[model samples]
Target: MIEHQLIVSILLIVAICLLLMVSHRIKVAYPVMLVLGGIALSFVPGMPRLRIHPDVIFLVFLPPILYEAAAANSWKELWHWRRIIGSFAFIVVFITALVVGYIANTFIPGFSVALGFLIGGIVSPPDAVSAAAIMKFVKVPRRVSAILEGESLFNDASSLIIVKFALIAIGTGQFVWHQAAASFVWMVIGGAGVGVLLSYVIIKLYKWLPMDENIDTMFSIISPYLMYICAETVEASGVLSVVSGGLYFSYRRILIIGFSSRLRAENVWNFLIFLLNGLAFLFIGLDLPEIMAGLKADGVNLWTATAYGLLITGALVIIRMGAAFSAVFVTRFMSKFITVADSRSQGMAGPLVLGWTGMRGVVSLAAALAIPLYIPGTQTPFPERSMMLYITFVVITLTLVFQGLTLPVLLKWVKFPNYDDHLPPEETERIIRIGMAQASLDFLQRNNKCADVKRSALLNSLVTHWNEQLESEGLATLYDDELRKNYHNILNEQRLWLNKLNNENERVDEEIVRHFIHRIDLEEECLLKE
Candidate 1:
């Protein structure tokens, strides 16, 4: 079994890599390709069934993903769209879950409201993994991106909470309205509080402890897990715990982390996220055959299950669209009375895009599979578990494939606004660079930090270089032309010398050459950042 698992893992990685190569040529979203690739590979003979334990995904896969998304976002920007994100994250999730649940209960045979809601909750929140992956290939306004990303980040808590309670209602056959309601409030408050507290303590510890860049980066990775575990231990929402912790730490990263740690952490986190996301989407595809088999064993016809899945998927999309448009309309109507600016009033394109971007991915599958196998008091299996899993799989497939594929076309049709609709990014970045350069020069001069004559002269030279460029073109690139040229010459010289030592003199170890090359690359990167 272990060897089979290893082979499957290796095969999946190779397939993902090949698909990624083709993704750029086809101009399709990478995650979508992974999904298709996974689906395609599953048809191969003797392919092992890849099972993702629900606890593993919820505990292991979720924390870092949530943390990275939360940390990457601008807290201020997220706050600006607080109302819209709130509507989509909390209100839309509840509305969609209830609507889908009620529809499933009414239309589907032998399915109760609890079962309907269980399916509803599983599919409610849009997967950030899918959304982020898709966003890489499309251009949308910053506000639109923020709202979608924010909705994905925060809505998991809302949907997961609903699923948790719905599962309880199903498992125990008891629904305590007041207790459930109170539980929701406590989870939200406690999760956020715990996350914030943990972040504070970690930041202080990071400051007091004498740790290297590697240790600091490791701590950065582990902090999210710690926050998540602490929240779950206290019966709070672990999703929210990860988000809050990620947000706090991300906002304060510049103040607490040194340059080397920040750079290394960024690279490390990026690679990890890519690998995790690829595996997740691939696993979604791999689960298809097993879910189909489950449906068959239960005497459910394939066509019947597919039709049911389609109906639920349709309901999910329609309900989400209605909620999104209604939220925009209501917010616009209320803005008049509140003296607030209506950003969505520009047009319906933004709302339309938001409504259509609801792609479900691994989370729904994990939740569906996580449903208990047997009832607590009886040997009977959980009600509608097979159907639920099948339906969840259908929703994930439909959204990820159909919506994911067409999103780029939709963006082009709508003429999606760029972040720099008002001002281009280069201009903004240049302005920021000028201010930063001026501030650095002022501080160095004021504090007499550059005691050496050459260092002080270099600082003066940089100030003059920036001032000249700003006066001429209102632009100051990261490096002065001469300084950049000099660095390149030095880098070229070092590389050539290393090659000579290795090839001609045979005097240098390969490890030493690689080490020196890495050091030079870092130095060059710093110059580029200047």
Candidate 2:
């Protein structure tokens, strides 16, 4: 049975890869393609039924995914858009849940408000993966991407907290406003504090320990899980824990590890995140069969459940649109009272795009699947559990497919102003390179005055190279085959000399020497790439 399972897993991975390739070729988002492909695969005559375990998703998948997204975010950009992101991530999520709860309670016979809130919480947070995938094919302002990505990082924690409260109310048949509010605040603050504390400890470990890049990268991989589990064990938010920890680690990365580790970790993380996301979307599709089966077992009409899903999805979109536009007005009003960044009106295009990009995915599905099979300490079934799963699945599908596909068209139709006030990318790169070159030149000139003639000549040559780079506006120097050969030979000689010096010099710090070597390696890499 284990061998069979392994083979099946391998086949599914292969299928995901093929679908990803197809998505790229067809200019469709991979999440949409993978989910659609998985659904189609489900209809095959001999296809195995795949069921998603909620614990597996929550424990194994979420921490690293949240951490990666958090780490990738720019602190400056996040701060600049913090108001919008916070509103969307926290306030809008609550509003959407409440609205969804109300709609569900009103329309669905016998469904209580708490149950509606449960489903609302499940679907409130938008998954960044689908929107990001779609945005790759379109030209969007940087602020839009930053806002969406930032919102996604925090919103998961907020929505899950709502789910937690709703579950508590349903299970125990009580809801207290003040206690729940206080608990929510504690969860956010405590989770963030836990993450920051753990990250500091890990950073110290990286600095104090005698470890290589591989060991450092391994520690980084474990850090998120440590933060998440630790926070959740204390009844705090694991999602917030991972996000805060990731952000802290990213900010302190240079202090904790050298360049080689950063390079290796980036490659490793990119591949890991890709595999995880692909499997997640694919699983969403594959799980459809199991969800349908559950609905059938419960004697719920498939059409009726689907209609409910559609209605909920429609309501979600409307609520998000209203919230998105309302945010602009709110920001404007708040700017009058205090400091604000870009208080200028964003107009309809930006909000419309933001509103339309509310694609739901793995988190919602996982949360729905996690609903208890029966009430605590009893055999009585959880009310409307299967129907909730079916509806959540429907919402995820419609949003991902419809919104994901239509996003590119929306971008083409809407004209977004240049939201970035900074210099163009090329100009920015040129300025940064020139500044680095100047700094290097100054450092070398100050240190090399007392050096021998041979060393002085070599240092002078490097100084000239920097001067040439400055004059050429930071462009690489044109090189012939002979020049390239000689340049590489010179670099090889430097490596040999450095290695000999390291071996002979007991006074030298090996870490400092290694840092220099890493810089040389990067330079050589750039040259080779050119």
Candidate 3:
């Protein structure tokens, strides 16, 4: 039976991967495809169903997802939009929880207000994965993407913290307002502190240890988990620990790590994230059968659960839209009273897009599952645990399908302004590489011995190339229109000659030829970027 289940799980993953590949070609968001595919597979005959323990998703999936999102965010942009992002992540999340919790309490029979709040918190924060994936083809403005990414980075901490306290209040039958507030402060501070401290330790290890790049990459993967575990052990927020630790490493990445390590780390983390995300979303679909069975066992039918789910999901969407609109006026108003930079100057369209982008995913599912089965101080199960899970799943599916599908239309309707004033990416790269090449020349002349004739010739050739690029670009020497053309011809000739030698010379090993060709290809790419 176990082996059969294992084979089923592997097949499920393979199916999800194939779905992702097909979805990519068709331009459908991957998470949306995964959820839809999972739902479709749930009813398959002879399918081996796998159960997800509440703790499994929380422990296995949440840390790296949060860490990668936070680490990849641009610190400068994140800080610049901190106020706006804070409003969405912290204030908007709190409000959505309250609104949705109230609706669930009033409408869903036997659902306690505390439990409603818990459910509310679960679905509050938007998952950026879908929105970001869609944006790759949709061409939303930079500011819009920045705000979305920034909100995603910190919102998990806020929503999860709310869930934490709500669970405590429900379990203990006592809710202290002051204690809750204080605990939040402590979690934020303590988690961030631990994350920073741990990040420094990891960075120092990278500098001090003489480990291989692959080993260093292994440690890099473990660092976020270390931060999370350490913070949770101290009763701090593991979510914040992962976020801050990721950000710290990202900010200091260049100073502490070498190029080869960076390359390996990038590739490793990309693949890891893809796998983790695929599994997390696939689990969401795969877990549906169990959640439905639990509901049935509790004497609640599918229709009743769906109705409550719609009510709660509607409340979440309405409240978030209201908050998004209010934020624009509020930010503008507060900017006059306070001296903080105004992030709302992009006007109404940006906020509307922000409001519309709140599609929840794995975090919501994980948080709902993380709810303990039995309430403390009683043999009875946690109040509305199954109902809450069902409702959370409904919200996730609806948003991912409805909102995620229509996001591109919304972007087109908004007609957000483009950033035409900035230099093209290739042009920017060309300009930067010109300076870099000159710096390389200076460093070679100052630090290295060029006594060997061949070595000296190479150094001189490199300096001449850099100088020619600078002059062609009109930075230092006179701008010659033909210098760029002449340089292009020279590079083209070098590539042709190298290719011919590789094909004609019997002594040239294919591996050595390919390596040199790769280097030349990189240089040629840089030259062409402008």
Please list the C-alpha lDDT of all candidates, in the order they appear. Answer: 0.77, 0.83, 0.76
TM-score of 1: 0.87
- Strongest candidate by TM-score: 2
Q: Considering only N, C-alpha and C atoms within 3 Å, which residue pairs clash in candidate 3? A: none
Q: In candidate 1, what residue range of length 10 has the lowest lDDT sum?
A: 502-511
Q: What is the C-alpha lDDT profile of model 1 across 84-186, one tens digit per residue?
A: 8888899889988999899899998978999888889989989877776677887677777778888888888998999999988987898999999999999
Clashes of each: 0, 0, 0
Candidates, ranked, TM-score:
2, 1, 3
Pairs in steric clash, model 1: none
Count of clashing pairs, candidate 2: 0
RMSD of every prediction: 9.9, 7.6, 9.8
What stretches of model 1 exceed 4 Å from their correct place?
339-344, 416-423, 449-457, 469-530
Scanning candidate 2 in windows of ten residues, the lowest lDDT window is 449-458
Ranking by lDDT: 2, 1, 3
Give all TM-scores, in the order shown.
0.87, 0.89, 0.85
